[model samples]
Target: MTQTAKQAGHILIVDDNTDILIAAKLLLKKYYQKVHTTDNPFDIEEIVKTQPIDVILLDMNFSQDAISGKEGFYWLKKVVEQDPSIAVLLMTAYGDIQLAVDAIKAGAADFVAKPWQNDQLLGAVAAAYAHAQDKQKVGQLTRQTQGLNQALNQGAGGKNFDFLGQSAAMQQVFSTIEKAALTDANILITGESGTGKELAAHAIHQASLRRENALISLDMGAIADNLFESELFGHKKGAFTDAKADKVGRFELANEGSLFLDELGNLPLSQQTTLLAALQNRQVTPVGGNKAIDVNIRLICATNDNLQQAVDEGRFRQDLLYRINTIEIRLPPLRERSEDIPLLVNYYLEHFCHKYKRTLSVSDTDLQTLSAYAWPGNVRELAHAIERAVILSEGELLDISTVVGQVTTTAQPSQADSAQSESDQLVNADTFNLEELEHRTVRAALKHYQGNVSQAAKALGLTRGAMYRRLEKYDL
Candidate 1:
């Protein structure tokens, strides 16, 4: 095969015979990206250290009548000690078959005798290069898996309420997850931004047959447009400007496990086709890599958007939606299941109290007040609110003000104030100063949304930037 048709690598040749070094370099350089030869056996370590050598060709007899091959064995040990993953090919002038068998037993990849045919030399080098690549890839995979497992454990620590609810809505969700976890079907979880979609994914993976394997989670919305392919399918070294090393993609890392794609609805239509193709084919070809790697994964996707509506608007691919939604599960928002609020609140309260080493209690009145409020941001907002309350509390009672900020009377005006409409109440303030009224209105909007700037801005008919400016102007 031609050089372009073959899988190329970096070759290092170390031999005391200058003629042998010259001949090997001339022949191998035609097929490999790099071929470095040295006549001094002592320079092996320096050369290997400086270059990304995939395979090393060492002379079995460095000195004349050095047929015992002790020098070759010494250099071979040095090479292996430097990197056990590197392949070392032993070459000798003495054609001793027993010596070849001995070299194989001593960690040498292969042994080549002198007067070797050109084709035989090329085949041996190619085999050694392939061995080195395989060994390096396996090492990288093991390290990556360990790192991924560590992250997964840290993330799981916060998911204590994965199945902590007693409401009918949550019970149904648990039932569906239990049934789906038994099969190898693709699952799509639809919920508001903070309804615990990621936790649901974790629950499914933990209960499934692939629980022992990795559960790779990727936030689709967080990835940049240019990096979508490389992040999901992986990239080889030198594939792009920033690709300095080979990457194992989420799909490959989650092989025979689960791959959770969060915020999948935020993915643009242009990139949806690429993801769809990989799912349909069960294979991913890394950037700058010629061969395709097969992946066996159970797909789990979560999104806050109404994907069917997105498909109707031509913003999301219909086929892709169909592929991911083989088994759909929708989580009810906090507002929809108001009764479950107390359970979530108590859970987070205990969790935060233990975490912060504080003693705090929530009264029934406070629980009622919390349940009555419409939590637009859902469970995630409530979680932050409780944690904020715990950390900022100095007394035995949980400080609700620190959690939700100052509550404006606009949400629940007194009987006398109820007679006046919201706009009338604002206009009839003691002072008609526009500045004072504007500040009060801004503060109220912020408190009503529980500090959600976007929702507050939308409620007051202002853009996000305009809202930010107002907050800056009022210093609120």
Candidate 2:
């Protein structure tokens, strides 16, 4: 690497001889941005705590005629204990093969002999700095992965869903996602609602070179326009009324990994301008901060809306579309891939059966019934149907009677028709208990929509959370 390229690294030299310390710092400072030196080993801890030192060069002997390398071993342990990611190189004039092996075994990064050639010393320091950087990246990636996993589990209720398909249309999607994962180019996934767009994003991330790092996914449709900049670029403490503390934005959190932005077409023209600038510059400035932070993330965006139509209609920016869609992956809706329905149904059935602790088997007739239905909610709808069936059906052979309903309506019907139908169905009820009435209503809604939660919630004038609560409260 060029000296300018290595300017971000910091080096520390610890030696008993002032001459050695000065010479080393003078030569290294020209290449590295920061160079520290101290003769007393006692000051190592304080320097380490205060400065972001990437590599340390230490002398094995601290006293005259001292060559056993015991002092070097002691400080090496101390430095590593303080920060395991920092690389430490041990040096001694009386070095031997045994001492080198011992130093390495004691956590020293490398061994250097005293009176080393200038080129040799520089190469050692450079190698040590690179090692430190790798360790730092690994450590940061681990912490970010843990945080992202926790966030996903909490937000998605720990749903474990994967893309499963064998039809022609789906094979094409799989091919495109695989090709996209081989590069760092930005990707745009387009499909109808509930067509597993997010699942495609996850597949790309898992297959990509950045798989070891966290894949940060955000729903662009859920972000309010006013909070768009603060959410994507972050904000400092006291930046605004609700800015309680310094927050890292999604872009920063996804550095050196992948950032999946769902519902990109829902982004307004005004906010598109800000997002465009960040992607173009590869950096983001916090709301109240002047310095911009550089980020390296593979961009993956999904949208059900027609971005091309939106751009032509003057809703989306043409330049932003060009920036995001270096590669476009269009997922076929469930209806277009009906041949894969049986496979999806069986997978979900097995999963939900295991989850709900039931021994059940689906009949060929039931599978055929499911395969024929027009699933407006796609695979998500199919999975929910199977889960509900597993929970509600009794006595073996998978009762899908509750999963089949009349002509599927994408939206809620008029209030008159809904109330009249509900009343007629309730006219034969045996009890007047409010709880019992609510349970029956929830069950009917689920049945009417074939286990589609969003539609059922809308039909009952309840949020999805309320619908879920009813399902759990009555164990239906």
Candidate 3:
């Protein structure tokens, strides 16, 4: 998957008023990709079960004569019980501060009053989304670490360095990695993607005091927001709908080891705050479980983006930065450290040459030119280019264009752009599109069942999850 795909977030808004639902959808649709709004409180569970909703903006009262948020409490309890990872923000009167605080203690993530400013709503929603994402991540990694095969854990985390380069930049990086690894400090490595960030993280883990323990690595950017918690912290049997078995979380799995969270920037600000809390407390509770598990772990993080800039722009949390980044190690891009290009190219070339059974080699002139060419994708891109050249080599000499000259890239559409593109295709009534017909049939079944997602899914021979995704896709 592309990096952007890993950073996507979704939201859901629930209210009894159609106008409020419409306004919330319109305002939030700009910031979030999957925005779903429903006026019926009964439909909330079905929507949550079927959709990848990160957070919900819930109204406190559903009855016209209701003044107290008793109804809100009922639904909030249901929502929290449905998935403890999903953040619910209660919307109530400005004078309901006491009720709001009570709701928070009861598990409501945050409370926002009625007639809110755009920024206030945006900030709250943003935070809710981030919180859900963090919970999801910690849960996911925990589970993932638990399910990992023994061979996978030991394959390369401690054994590989491949981090070569004796340049001044290289010497400093090597020195920092060695010195920082001895201490249990939280180390944050920053550089462009493909600049060997993961390699550095793993190296740190290998050199650390926890090297005898498992060196668990996670790519924070590639994980989906919905599965984030399940993958990190784990879930109980029958947690939500899909979790069928009790599983261990990453923190528990990395209990006495080092946990390397790659692409730390990919984490949302909401998650950053919660992650900071968990790390500070050194404890995590499994989803759907009230008991907390204590863990002793060394933390290492890496990211491709400038975290300081993201914090300045308010896209990331500043306090969380201070927590994870106790000591910072900046990796110089390959272009800036051109002296290392030759070594990197030769390493990949030799490896690819043997794999493809080709006696091909790069000439001095071509190699020099390649070393001088700007590598926008960094070492990872260069390695890929070399592999491609080896596979397609015609003779003993590899083509220069195929050597670090060709890089792979992926383009993904923004949620808005994708929606616009899907809607842009005008459907002529004269023609019958089977896909359109299927969509209509699904919508009809869903409407007939009054948004009974399970019944509709059964009627359409689809799992409820599949049915919900379609509803989201067609904006039903």
Residue 212 lDDT, candidate 3, scale 0-100: 85
User: Which one wins by TM-score: 1 or 2?
Assistant: 1
Residue 394, candidate 3: Cα error in Å is 2.0
For 1-476, candidate 1 gives per-residue lDDT tens digits of 33455355778898888899899999988888889888888887777655667899999886654789988888898888877778999998888888999898889999999978998999898889989999977965784686476556656543466556788999899999999998999999987656788889989999999999888888776677888888788887778999997776787778888999987877878899999999999988777664466789999999877889889989899999989999999999776787899999998999899999999999887887888766655787788889889999888999888767644423444323332343465666788888879876875665554444555677989865577678657544
Candidate 1's C-alpha lDDT? Answer: 0.80
Estimate the overall C-alpha local distance difference test score of candidate 2. Answer: 0.80
**Weakest 10 consecutive residues, lDDT, candidate 2?**
407-416
Task: For each candidate in the order shown, give its overall lDDT on alpha carbons.
Answer: 0.80, 0.80, 0.74
Q: Each candidate's root-mean-square deviation in Å?
A: 8.8, 9.0, 21.6
Candidate 3 per-residue C-alpha lDDT over 1-476 given as tens digits, one digit per residue, 9 for 90 to 100: 11223225667788888888888888777777778888888998888766666888989888753678888888999988887788999987544778988989988889998888878898888888889888977865655565666427446642343777877998999999999999999999887656787888778887888888876777676577776676567667777788888777667778788888876776777677768888989988777664466788898888766778889989788888898899999888776787887888888889888777888888887777777665545676677778788887787898867444442223433334433433343233344887876665664564444333445677889864576577656545
Cand. 3 Cα-lDDT: 0.74
In the predicted model 2, the residue pairs found to clash are none
Residues forming the 10-long window of minimal summed lDDT in candidate 3: 1-10
The TM-score of candidate 1 is 0.65
Return the TM-score for candidate 2, rounded to 2 decimals: 0.60
Model 2 agreement with the true structure over 42-65: per-residue lDDT tens digits: 998878766778899999888844
Cα error of candidate 3 at position 66, Å: 50
